[model samples]
Target: MISYRWLLFIVLFVGIFATNYLAMTVKEPLAASAAFTLMVLSVYGLEKFYNRGPEKVTDERTDLINMKAFYYGSLALIVTLMFEFIWLVSEDYETAVLMAKYLLMPFGAMIAVVVLSKAYLERVM
Candidate 1:
């Protein structure tokens, strides 16, 4: 049976797609929405396929690794966000348009930190 998490992701994808489509004033909304939906479904399917394994058993070690990874990721996110804020404030940002463009850096930093930290922790611990 499908889970609520999957439904939430699908809804988020559709909402994001619709928001961007409307904002960009795209001509072919139908085709774009169909393609976006297909892409989201394909990714969801791929994740499901990849996760078809035995049920996960978490223990102290696994929990510690995850905790540390999240800690590092949060640190990286905060640092990057601080830097982004400083840079933006040093310059001139009339609206949130420029701030929106800069937001990806912190997000990428967080993801990179989490992935790398998890990989390293898994290997070492």
Candidate 2:
């Protein structure tokens, strides 16, 4: 029997292909809507699969490793976002604000969450 992980992989693979095909052939607004919807649903599925516990889906050690990896990934995302924001600011204040609004805050939030979670986990573990 195919595992749920493989099922999730298959769904995401198909979603990516469908999104690419639809985006190229469809109207921009429709394509954007479709992509957004697909992304939301994909994330929902992933969250349900990975976030719930006691299933041996992953152990405490694995979770700690994953959290550590997330912390690093968040760091990278925030650093790149800051550089982008600086470049945007050099270009124009209005553009900088617009770009930073979409980029910096979300990345910063993720970094904070990951860093704190990793710290807490390390302390307890």
Candidate 3:
């Protein structure tokens, strides 16, 4: 049977290709490609970390760490959203519409915070 890791890798590869292709069609292809390369490397490193050991069952400590990480992540998301709201409020309609493309930034920040906090908590506690 196919593994989840392979599936994730395949999806990421497809996304990378699609992103680069679209980026090449845009004006700043070089900058986009550089950013994409960095993102790919980061994902590859994370994949290596995940596959470094056999999967383990979650325990009580793990649960506690995740809960706290989630709390911190949610707080970050709230703060990010507040900033986004202020930016939107201060902009004209056209500018606001343009900035709306970054609506996912807060979600991305939340995910990053959650992942980083969970890793730190695991090491500390």
Please give the CA lDDT of all the candidate structures.
0.61, 0.61, 0.60
lDDT by residue for model 2 (31-59), tens: 53455466547756776876787766778
User: Taking the tens digit of each residue's C-alpha lDDT, what string does model 3 give over 1-125?
Assistant: 66767866775786566444444344344444454555556666866766888766988887878785567557666545544443443334455555656766756876787788778987989
lDDT of 1 at 95: 42
Query: What 10-residue stretch in candidate 2 is worst by lDDT?
Result: 23-32
What is the C-alpha local distance difference test score of candidate 1? 0.61
Model 1: weakest 10-residue lDDT segment is: 87-96
Better of 1 and 2 by lDDT: 2
TM-score of each: 0.42, 0.38, 0.34
lDDT of 1 by residue, 13-105 (tens): 875565355334454444444554555556657667767899679899989788855675576566455444434433434443577667778
Order the candidate numbers by lDDT, best to worst: 2, 1, 3
Model 2 Cα shift for residue 81 (angstroms): 14
Off by over 4 Å in 2: 42-116, 119-125
Q: Single out the weakest 10-residue window by summed lDDT for candidate 3.
A: 84-93
